[model samples]
Target: MDAETLEIRTIEVTPNAAGDASTLPDLLAQVPADERITRVGGDGAYDTSKCRAAIAARGADAVIPMRRGGQPWTTDAPGVDARNETLRAMKRLGRTIWKEWSGYHRRSLIETKMRCFKLLGERVASRSFDRQITELKVRAAVLNCFSQIATPHTIRVA
Candidate 1:
């Protein structure tokens, strides 16, 4: 990210975040239990009951994929092997809607939001961690406070 007021700062490298239930709990401890988290999308990495419980505790609707050797989300659904085969052969236009399709559609929306936040908010190229967080919060607060000024209908440049 770009530095403060476009000022450059020394970078500090941290270890890659760890995985597993214990790791998740420790890392997310700062997040309040009552915070209204809507949805959490995760991969096979989140398999343990503790992971699920922790997410659900935040009142979030989790969309984590059940890991291999773990309980299936739906017993009637075909195996991953078959699903992979279908995904490889089918095109988006003619293919039937499936679980992967749902995930892709939803994930794309999230990607768009992040891209907009990065571009319009000048948040993508941050100088440091604290600056990055500040930029995001500042952008959101500014937008909320001056929503009408930002809206196309009310914007009349003199």
Candidate 2:
């Protein structure tokens, strides 16, 4: 989703056994080839080579943070060198500052969307797989509409 607009761009429904890292490549594929994405942000859970590679393959900066006690990448993978550079920055500038510099904080925008989804309802009412997906899509659409309608109009007071 766009950070400013909160408009969803990709939706992938994977089985429980598949971790987020595994589904990332598929999710990234949903982005239009012509679109120029600047950054892809995720929590520490996505701080793996596969996820990083998927982001780098799309020519976007990975805003994911390394986990505690995380080691710098030693391989020549797509995003490993950049990850190592980020690790060094984290070491020198500290985690908080590095996160700020890297725009990792934007990850919370998705979290806010999740929170709104939960607020609508935690459990899917539909029993069938296709129906459940449809339900989720409908919910996402509603939330997006609500977000648009609720956006404040700034009136400058002299």
Query: Tens digit of lDDT per residue, candidate 2, span 95-153?
Result: 99998898878878878887987899988899988998888888888888999898888
Highest TM-score scorer: 2
Q: Please state the error at residue 94 of candidate 2 in Å.
A: 1.2
lDDT of 1 by residue, 44-138 (tens): 57545565666656655545444444432332332333233433433333333534554534655544444544566542467786776566666
TM-score of 1: 0.40
- Candidate 1 has an lDDT of 0.45
Q: Cα lDDT of all candidates, in order?
A: 0.45, 0.86
List where candidate 2 sits over 4 angstroms from the true fold: 155-158
Give the least accurate 10-residue stretch of model 2, judged by summed lDDT. 7-16
Clashes of 1: 4
Task: For model 2, name the residue pairs that clash.
Answer: none
Model 1 CA lDDT for position 92: 37
Per-model TM values vs. the true structure: 0.40, 0.90
Q: Which ten residues in a row have the lowest lDDT in candidate 1?
A: 1-10
